[model samples]
Each structure stands twice: as C-alpha cells, then as structure tokens.
Target: MSSLALHVADKRPEDPADLTGFYAGLLAVLNDAALNHHGWTGSVVADLGEIGGYVYMKIRPGEGDEPFATIEDLRAFRKRQAEEARRTEEASKQARLI
Candidate 1:
C-alpha cells in the first residue's frame, strides 16, 4: 500500500548515540513532512503496531491525486490511494549505504 524504509542494522541509531530519545529527535524533521504531506502519521501507527521507521512523503507536490470518498470510487481510482496496492508499478527495493 505504501513505500517503506528498512534500517538493516545490529542496533538502532539513537542507542549508539547514547542520548535519550535521540533517534526520535532525528526523526522530527521527517515527522513534520510526513504529518503535512500524508493523511496518516506513521509514528502513531508505529506506536500502535510496535514497529518503527514507517512514513509518508509527498513525491508529487504540484500533482494532486484523484479524490475518492465512496467504496466504489476507491475501487475505481487506483493510481495511488491510502492502503491500496499498485497494479501499474511493481514492488521494488534498492539499498543505499547512506
């Protein structure tokens, strides 16, 4: 339904830094963007689901997606909608050292 960032690591970043809630602080900027651009907040989901690092981003700032309210409307419009799979674009992942 959405893209995810995987942190392949032996430990979480903030733990090594040894500062209280350090990773959360680092994620604040991302949280801001996620809150503004996307309809749902990932950190809240993370808290409920006991997971982390999930978020939403506005890749197309100028382009707006078709709005759908009804269930049939949702079923019809499928370029990108919340929690819906993409038929046009295949799933993929590319790693970076960063």
Candidate 2:
C-alpha cells in the first residue's frame, strides 16, 4: 500500500466558491474511481480552507486481496466525522452557557 498527498492551490480564483468547486471536482474523480472499481482499496482525506486545500489518500488491498471500500463509504465516513465534530462543538457551547 502506498500513501499519496496532493496539495492544490488556486490563486487565479478570487472567489472562494470557484476554488471550492474545483476541489470538489477533483474529489469526485477519485471517489468515482473507487465506486467503479472492485479491487480498489483506498480512502481520501480532503482538507479545504479559504487559502487552498490538500488531499491525502491511501491505497491498500483488502483482506483476501479484494476491494476495500467505495466512494460512498468514504463520504459517509467524512460525514460522520464532521457530524461528531459539530456535536462536540455544540456540547461545548452548551456547557459554557450553563
């Protein structure tokens, strides 16, 4: 298994939305490959901010040398992580209010 890290910067786009869309498109391509292939095993982490972004991915074979997960799976994991962070922040806010 090999690990890959990609850093992307878009200075041409003054609008943050444009930069974000560009990043999202790149992620879609990676996720699409995961969805279409069976023997593809990897997860991608996208760190997007106002300045730029980075994508960290790992490729590995699954047990029995099968595909590990799909793009949807990665997306679900990201969603869950984000939700957990949000919940934690909310809890902290509530605690501070008390």
TM-score of each: 0.24, 0.40
lDDT of 2 by residue, 16-76 (tens): 6685465456555554555465334544454433334444443333335444344555566
Q: Which digits, one per residue and each the tens of the lDDT, describe model 1 over residues 15-89? A: 455432433443444445444555423432121111364322212111244321222322233223433444323
Off by over 4 Å in 1: 1-18, 42-98
Candidate of highest TM-score? 2
Q: Measured by TM-score, how close is model 1 to the native structure?
A: 0.24
Q: What clash pairs does model 2 have? A: none
lDDT of model number 2: 0.52
Candidate 2 Cα misplacement greater than 4 A, ranges: 1-51, 58-66
Whole-model lDDT values for every prediction: 0.32, 0.52
Top model by lDDT, which number?
A: 2
